[model samples]
Target: MPVLRAPEVRRPGRGDPAVGHRQAAPPPDARAVRRRRGPDGRRAMSEIVFLFPGQGAQHPGMARELFGREPVFTEILEEFFELLDGEGKRLRDDWLTDDPAVPLDEGRRAQPLLFILGYALARTLETRGVRPGVLLGHSIGELAAAAFAGVFDLPAAARLMEARSLALDGSPSGGMLAVGATPEELTRFVDPPGRPGGVVVGAVNAPRQTVLAGPEPRLGEVERALEDAGTPGRRVPALQAFHSPAMAEAAEVFTAAFAKEELRRPSLRIQSTRTARAVRPDEATDPGFWAGQVAGAVLFWPALEALLAEGDFTLVEVGPGRRLSTPARRHPAVRSGRSTVIPMLPSTAEGTWEFWTAALDALDALP
Candidate 1:
């Protein structure tokens, strides 16, 4: 009885497929620049720009609490999981609610569950008339954003998540260490010129926040070095080091699977983490573009810049965890500006009602 209302999977021949091949969009009106003052001589929210989080952000009893508490969220999530099951990928975790019986933190279920949570939450927001003018995700979060922007439907996205995770399963086991240091400072430790190890800058979240990925054993040395230098370095609980050269084989497998998918032109702007720009129609569909994501550094900082350039936008972190919001709120741009960054769900044990109300209140106060 769950509501299965996700948009139908559009095909090239069935829908307006030519839209993705269009040339780069013209720049926004110069008059559309950020307005320091509204008619009341105060700042105002002009648009909603969704920011999706990746793996490290997820925790047990996340969106599930929302499902158990909110009828709409529950229906949509259950329906989406049904679709994913139809695609031969099952939600190994009891994702519709926070069930203590099913362990939710397993690696095999992370990507798919996160995608469903994000996609379903977006759907819930739409029922309240809150649509994203721009969309961006943190690392693995981009996959969920892609689905939100019509790159693919839930079914195709489910397949991609499973295939990508399966491919990653074949890669050597590794881990990621989050450091409160710039990529420049961490360079020498990552795959240095003369080294037997293979570490690399996996994600560039901000000027000072970068994630280093490599064999778990090698990452220990890097962590110790950071500590010795008075820098903060903590391991992100993960079994496989993603977004590094260690993911080469996974990238190849994902590329082949991605090529077969039919990516639709987005109804709104969906920024790319690969190049830190709004994804063009062709580039959005290019298998090679998505392939690069596996082994390339996540340019989250630059992509955030691209999102802010589009006038005053409410950077809504529309997924579980504050991983993306934590840094974004501290980024010089957001910290200095009057812009707001609100998270849809808090990582704590608080129920989803307060957070959901917060989002509704924020959108209600928008210009």
Candidate 2:
């Protein structure tokens, strides 16, 4: 229930594409539309997808209390530290407290730690009889989702995450920004001269929340232009320009990492960004697909569209921040109809265990 504050850091400096602008315009309607009733006058049966948020969603003290209370949680944490810390030193200190010396903010520590914590939280929820019918994840969170869907064991996921973080270290300095426009409008905004180094739409999050990633200067210009145009926007605190061409090196590293690890078929369905299709663990193991994911925009829109087509689906956003859930709740199928979306992280005064119990009860209560 504690509100963890981000460390005070300066905004990144200018780079690559030069800045530009335009006059303010009306903001796009970012609200979710409700679905009208069908001819049968009955709502459809609902399914569920366990959604995971990535990277910036992590905070310093996430799951520290949970680790203290649960031995299983502690075991997982220790295992993660062991895998990451080849020197056999404790990595727990970096995550458990707010000490600045450990530098939990770095991509190397942040990615693996987030994955372990997310997995622990998902396991905790499962202990309370809460399980998703399907799994989906955004960005790095996809690793956790793959594990949850039984694509790989926790150890394999941990190694993959560590390799991913290391591969991304010292990469180019491009960034991502969430835009408040329809995908079409945003595409125009990021096109040709409007973009620097040819900024690409990274993720089509929702009807109104598409993310654009590219050179830092170009991204800054786009942000300023959006604000000046009366379109509310914010920069996602991401180190590398993920899902952009800039990540090709990281993708290659990820491919090698996966090739070294033994991958098995997933027990549950995994929605892949590379193929925009439901893939099994074995299929996901294709080095090309894993590598392609780094260079490709997350097909979150397709994943969501697939879920909606299933008619009824309860969506649970697991982990510290609410990035995934925020955009997902705005979907017409999830908002105006039978589906339910909830966060597993403790965002309120109530303890997470309490929240987990309530979420299970709510799921049970769902028709």
Candidate 3:
């Protein structure tokens, strides 16, 4: 495939986050990207990508204020909830209310909550004529992307979520830690053979950032060791260790259950984090692929590179928190002047119209 890179313009001044990124200045052929025009002389929105984040990105009472502020958002969310049964309803209540019995961070609750919010936001964006050119998801987020891509019907996706959550949440509990080191430095901890089974790099989020998952005891050792060496690792808020052998048992059960669900050819392009690049539409719905995603490492950095390398794409992080957007902005290949990182419902959203309007203006995906 040919590479398409956006033009590098001077980043915004100091106090701006864009200055820290290292963008490549586009070569001669990139000039046409500026002159490309539609029949009516309007700029076409052919490169806007929707980014969906997985676990650890949700916030407390995330949608509490969202209901009254954006009616369209409320409409879509309510419709989505209507499709769920009792368990889904209870989880939704706990997620939107100020304080509730079931914790939003519960492994079972977090996956579906993020999926619901992410899908609802995608629908709301569609109402405003902002459709995604491609979809990229991290781990469980792929299910939502597949749903939006029409790879599976909505009900099938919901059922898959419920079953997959049960499989993972009921498995042996584990832990995850975010290390502030590159993969080369991380080799000593994850690559050494004959060690306890739980420890391995879960996801390579960026060139300098990686998340490790395994038994809590072994993870603690790695965390303390990294800190002792002057590079501290932060504990990820997770109930179980994912993307490691710790999840292998659960993955087998999930794969068996999910295989019964029907899958159709996708309507849109999907770039999976499991492979860290775009694959054929059929590969997206493979039961084995979904199963492997549970136990395999998430190649997020390379997947992100694939998206950024395709010029003129604005990464609109559709779900809660700017976790994915933060790293994309800091990636070396990103050109902040053209391709930008936008968060639809950031931590500061607080369910307000003014904030959303500002976010849309920032996105600037439309002519």
lDDT top scorer: 3
Give the TM-score of each candidate. 0.82, 0.78, 0.83
TM-score of 1: 0.82
Residue 149, candidate 3: C-alpha displacement in angstroms: 0.4
Q: Candidate 3's residue-wise lDDT over 1-367, tens digit each?
A: 1212222322232122432322323221133334445688766544778888888887775644455445566765666666677876676677656565666666787888888778777876777788888998887777778888887777887778778877976667677889878878888777453244658889989888999888766777877878878888888878788888878878888888778988777788888888877857668668877767888888888898877777667678888777788888787645435555667664643433334445654544255
Local accuracy by lDDT, each model: 0.69, 0.65, 0.71
Is candidate 1 or 3 superior in TM-score? 3
Error of 2 at 218 (Å): 3.1
Q: 82-164 in candidate 1: lDDT tens per residue?
A: 66674322363444345524345544566667777787788778777888888887767888888888888777876787788
Error of 2 at 166 (Å): 1.4
RMSD of each: 10.0, 11.4, 10.3
Q: Which stretches of candidate 3 lie over 4 Å from their true place?
A: 1-46, 68-72, 191-196, 333-336, 348-352, 363-365
Clashing pairs in 3: 198-214
Using lDDT, rank the candidates from best to worst: 3, 1, 2
* Candidate 2 C-alpha lDDT tens digits along 110-154: 677777777777776677566777778777777787777666787
